[model samples]
Target: MSGSGSIITVLDMFGARLPGDLAFSLSQCGSISADHPLAGEIAAALGGKAASLPYPRRQDFMWVTLAPTAEQLRCVIEDLRCWVLPSFGWESSPPIVSDGGPAGRMGALLLAQSPQGYFRWHSRPADTDHVIARLATMRAVIAQAPARLSQLRPTLEMLRRQFTLGLATGDRDMALQAIDEIDQRQLDTASNALSMSIRVAAAFGDDQAIVDHPQLDNLLSMRVPQRVIESVLLAHHAVFLADLEAAGDIKAALAAYLPLHDRLSGLAGHPADDADTGIVRMAAYDAALAEDARRLHLLADRFAGDTVVAALVASPPPIAPLPILEPAGQPAPETEAQSVEPAFGEPLQPSVAELETVRVAPVAVTAEPALPLGWSDVPALVATSAREPLAALLQHAALMPDACDPGDGDFLIELLTDSEIIADTKKRAQADQVLTTVIDAYVCEERFPRRERLGLYETVLDIWSSSRALSTDPIDGQLLLTMADALLRLNGHLEAAVATMITRWWEARPVRSRLAWLGEALELLTEQSSAQDYLGLWYAGAGLINVDHEGFSVADRYLWYRLGRRLGLDGTATDEALGVDWLPLHSADDPLLAAGFRKIAIVSLHERAAREAAAQIEDRTQAHVVLVTDHAAGEGTASAATADVILFVWGAAKHAVYRAFDKVRDRLEYVQGTGSASIVRALERRVRAAGG
Candidate 1:
């Protein structure tokens, strides 16, 4: 009871909102037994409680956080003495300072318990040149193998956090020094692949650092870790070496790097392990490097330029004089820039004097200028095409109908299959991109058009489905989506389109959301109601195990928009909503929606519950309740008598509507009543009767 005030102060230090998880973790602790009722509840809430931090999470608190059970007051103190403080020299200097700031005061007010949450009010930055010097000192102790080496792993991890801090502070020299210390002191085998890769990339601009230290060679050449890491490292080094050769001292650079390249090239046939799954090979990079020595030779093959040779043959050498040749009776020496007087008022120019004396004849050299290489040249020599052009070709595919030759799509597929492009996971993804571009081109409307574009789709799909029996890449699936979209517009099998694309992929929930968004995008792009709306709904709903109520709303919006003015949504209604539509639904192109007729009836299908739910609509709409699936005088169907709604029940299969079209009405009826059936039925009858 006497210490209640002190405990109260400790609790107060935690406050309403903990500054960080470490602070919070340290707070929900103290004197509460593990078997207590609150223990399970508290720990469960703490799991991933870092996610519930205020809005944006600070990265600093991710590591070095303190998590203590509520049972012990000094559990944190024991932890402080063992892990946090000893390395930090907490006996003399703690890891943190308080200074009575908001955090400091709050911490003090809560942790009124001394020692465990103690901190100095203020402090200054480190005076050491190497932030890692402390780590370098500790590495010696850990390497001694004094039974404390197991503790070495976590301590070194703390060193990694410090390295990240160095990165954040933009301290390159400190970062480099720290890495050098790790390689030199702690790691006897090889540096971690992820850490080493980051260092190599970071050293891109720092040639002096790379050349002065061959630590990269050690990092890359290390024997064992993960094969994926090894393959990735090899590729990364190959790219870096190629870049440096282009921009730096080619001779010196290649001499230092050729050995590495040869070693990596020798590893080309290394068995496909887990890491090799995503790799895509770049044969062009290999081919380009093969020409490096030849290119160097070509650049240096400056064998006496045309200007030098022409000067040698036509003019005398600078020091060697050309004596005047006496032409029988005349001397031929009027070649100095001296003033020569012609008996005129002005001094004669050098050109005038030279023309008067020299009798040189004109020479006509018969030579034609070279014509530049056009499309034929590039297509012929397609050995090493630039990646930039490929990007452009894919981006503006509309312009590139002949991007590949007539049978070249097949050639590309074969090339992908045969090459080491899938040598690793990274490159495997690239292969997918290459394949997707080809598919996107063939499926595009403006590029291929409808004349035979569907044939292209069949060809590509055949090639894909037949090859290696691999699953279609997600991007390639988009090709099917586009085709489905087109088939719907062409009045082809929209339901089949939906079913085929959705069959394998609809199981993922997020994929369903994407489909839903796409459907909404399509509906908002419509002119009037068509059966295509069903495809859109099916497409959006295709990828979900469980769908949201949003699908119903999408269907409702489309139905209302399709019905238009009768539903009070088209004509002036649309104009009030959208400023202008380029192809207005009420235009000469489409007059169906323009005239909302009262006649015309077709069978509308919905569940029995739906009819009962629209019961209030019965007062306003003249609809006869037809039990579901009751078309053509069947037991479940309603009689086609009186002006009432011919409700046709469409079950889960949206395509059943089209399949059951024959039973909808033997001939169209002038459905003189409310709802979609009346207008639809009347229009069909009008079209059939006016068949002139």
Candidate 2:
């Protein structure tokens, strides 16, 4: 009688069999988690003697409750397939019913994230849509946890991220709907619900719901450390409708936190002494200017370039000016890339000054039809950034006219980089449009306006220079390089040109063939001008220090911290003298690496860098020296925390890369684009978050 289905099917199949959700409604049953009351019932149903275990299903089916471990599931499969089902004379494994396998797995993961659940079932995306649906439900449950349980919201919120909303279709509707249902259910004397009605409401697409919660504002107003702002943001969302009061609380809470993105925490020589706060108050004074640029963009105003320039003082770390200079890579072929194509739009005379007149101004009174209505106009967050001719860009590039020459390609490339086009931060699912434009240009080896590209690069540099710009915003910074790399690689010059454009900070090549090739490219760079190349290498390597020391295992992370040691290894007396002061090597259990490494790691490393401020024994182990990362965000981004370590016992987790890779290969292959499979796979490995 076992089966998986809608809420009705679950009640029909397991109402008498289990205790939790169904049992509460059915009177005779009261001991199982709602998502899977019959995990044990079904497992026991495999035989018929399953009535042995107690009811109210252990709170959760995955980790905290009734869920089977991956190994147990494997055992179940084998037992049923080989032994149990065979007794019934079945030749094949019985297909176990489930409500979206990945979604179930996601629930299990969410439960395990906190002390909420006692078990976890690790699995891969067998069915993506199911997983997506389940994830929506899980996030709703997690968002509601804090109010129901008191203060576990931040921790659960962190865990919530483990399951990708699988929405890039990043729609708010699914998440919002699930959140609403969870809120509707009351956990009274008969309802054993760990109710956080305030939390469930936090999942609303509107941030104000959280801020308007009856009790959320007061709870959020408490001054936690400056590091926990995101948590505060999450908690404050629980606060309900009187937004001005909530906004006042937010501003106050922010003030009490006292740490700015630029505040240097571990300052020595009488900090908190009150007399000298101003001395170092403006130490990185220029960062204020950078913040000026940030504030403007957030407000959608035109921040003057000099404001950005003043905020950004350091000359860009002498990056090699992409020596090729031309995106076309090859010599003048009188082809689409090299020669001017004056036929379409306007002539390409290299003057980007026309931007003042043509670029979309922040205060433009009239919205042109070319511009799709967006955040300002729409009542909802419709992702309009790349909706502009997105699908066309891909087709145009993918099916480049075999007969077209330089003019057409130039016109297309130049048009794509226009200020209005480039500045659009449309939601990612929609980004395919802009990227398609870039990709097509690459496919046809078309040269864009070099001046525009350089200007954008300079602006990016300015934005990032003063902690105000935020290099950690993944999609904007490194991912851009990845996309850029894909385009260059498509044109075949990706090899000779990439290393010059991207910092060595990002080493995305995991699929060996690609790494071997990138290695070959680096070789060319080294050969081009040995000394200058080495300097570039060292300069690039400098970007790696104390990165993300927390998230990785001791050994894997140690490899990165030893950057200085890797440099000058060839015994060059000259290379040795350059003497880079790499952040000291840290072990996983080291005082700094694991020492509550999870808390405030990013800001400590990048923003309010208090070098030794929060360093503690990372692992409680007796091991000396902890392993740290080159990018604190690296550990978080890489998902090092969730990566499984190989286990010998059924209870232990495994960090089986091969097994993991095998599980997701099909999904990767399915999502990969034409003629660009290798590059796409390489990037998915790098940017799809860490443990994933």
Candidate 3:
């Protein structure tokens, strides 16, 4: 049937041909029917009978009962090349239908009859090859399905099925395309799509694809379930191993794997909640993890002489249990709390000055007892230097405050910077947890007093300078920048601590990760202030890096110049900063300069940038400059039409304006950035390419 209405009618006519008892039996056995033109041939293959079904004012079709012997169904499916429903009584042994091109059409008919049956049938492996081979037919069928089928089960399930089939067949391109469609449709399966795409890329040994996939970070930034995040990270580790094997570099790979190994080990100790929730087991995921672990152990054995690998494969260190702490003024138990010795050195007793700094407010005694280390007990914890239990409390406790108090801020900073706390990795993580919690409460919530918040910002800066200087960890850098952004929003000042951190991160390497962080830092700096000295520091550090390097991409340059212009630098200054003036732009008699346009039109949304670009062009080539500030302005349109060259600032111009200038597109040069130097650079390239 061509349309869904006709397909439904055909299904109804076929049902009418079946006896009520037979129909009920077929329904009970979870069998779906499709009217086939060669139903007689299929019946002969199965040694069954076929009946002709009559339809009012439509072509008659042949139908057969779903009940058939297992051997007969196998013969009909494999030999006769006909679609056969799963055996009438058995639901587990799904028949493997050949990809004879009619299977998808038959699936469409079955879908019209029973959508649930359609899904159940496709969920098995029988439909995998058929789904891939007749993908276009299946798509059309789904698109033209009845509204009932569309409403009950949307296209998301179909997309997931295709993705699953692609993975099963090792069709990486197909799987990635399915994921892209899911993203384009704005489906709610964003996390699932991202995880699937990563696994697909890793399975196909496309390590670069996994690294360059745009949604990887987006998925990480989401509040995804623990299982999903773990799966993504495991896939990342697999990519790392693949790269390592390809390079044949054991030492470098070991160095990269240690941090990831530590992180994964920590996660492995605490399995995700999915294990206990009885969710469906991911067999592929488990198999991949096991394989990766085996490979890792092999690598470790090969490099057993190396100390790090030896220590890694060795038995893990035992983790000490955390002791419970009692609130202030509570009666102590017969046994005292056992305190472990600080890792740094002997524990220092609380000073009198530190005790005096904690302000204790009056509290009313209530009938119900308060929890340990509650609000009232904070002052005591701060005053007594109860570092160990206080660190535990901060880790597990909700740090939301009722008021902005300098006393709470001081105690948190003290706990975070405590040498004893920073010595252990777990405790250091807990300290970071406390820092983020305080930031969320004091900075993000904005319920705290401004003066107190500023004081906390300064304390954070001091902590970063003193303790985090040597850390090149991207996660730590992100957290630092987050705090810096918060501080900038409050006081409109970029702390020198942040500036130094950015410089250090950039100089560490010109890798993509570092460049991404620099881009974020540049955005923040540009937003807060247009100080040339501050902006020039980044330009010198990042913008001046060798283009031959792997990480300094064209997109990165565009961003740097765009932000530089936003910081009040003109074409000449920006060009000089990057030594671009050494080019032929300074020579008036240069052929490229002489061959430049007599009249050029620049279109942009940023008026000052547009004017500056125009000035730069006129100064370099002695050409007349026309500024197109508005798309609808007649004078702008007229100037754009007659100009010898039209420079459309692609990043800063509206799409409607670009379209309006389509009549002059032949002479139009698409400029990527709104900066004056970018425009001049583009013009020079165009002239040179035109045989100037």
Best model per TM-score: 3
| Cα lDDT, all candidates | 0.33, 0.28, 0.46
| TM-score of predicted structure 2 | 0.22
- Candidate 2 per-residue lDDT over residues 220-253, each given as its tens digit: 3332211122222323322221232235442332
Work out the TM-score per prediction.
Answer: 0.22, 0.22, 0.29
Backbone atom clashes (below 3 Å) for every candidate: 28, 77, 0
Root-mean-square deviation (CA) per prediction: 31.2, 30.2, 30.6
Q: CA shift at 687, candidate 2, in angstroms?
A: 19
- Candidate 1 accuracy as TM-score: 0.22
**Model 1: per-residue Cα lDDT over 1-692, one tens digit each:** 11445544443333233343223333455433454322322332234110011111232111122122221223434543553344543332453323233365545543333312333211112311121233233333444645634444433433443343333222334445656667767642354533343443332222233333445555434432232233343344444443443354333433444444443432222122211211212111221233322111211122123222122223222232212122233354355612332221122233444333322110111111222432222222223444455444443332232333324344445435544554545344444545544543344211222534454444454444334223333333333333443444344444444444444333333353344333322332232234443443443343231212222332233333333333334456533332232112323322233233332223433232233223422322333333333323332332333223333312111221222233343332322222333233334334445451
lDDT for 173 (candidate 3): 52
Q: Model 3 residue 470 lDDT?
A: 56
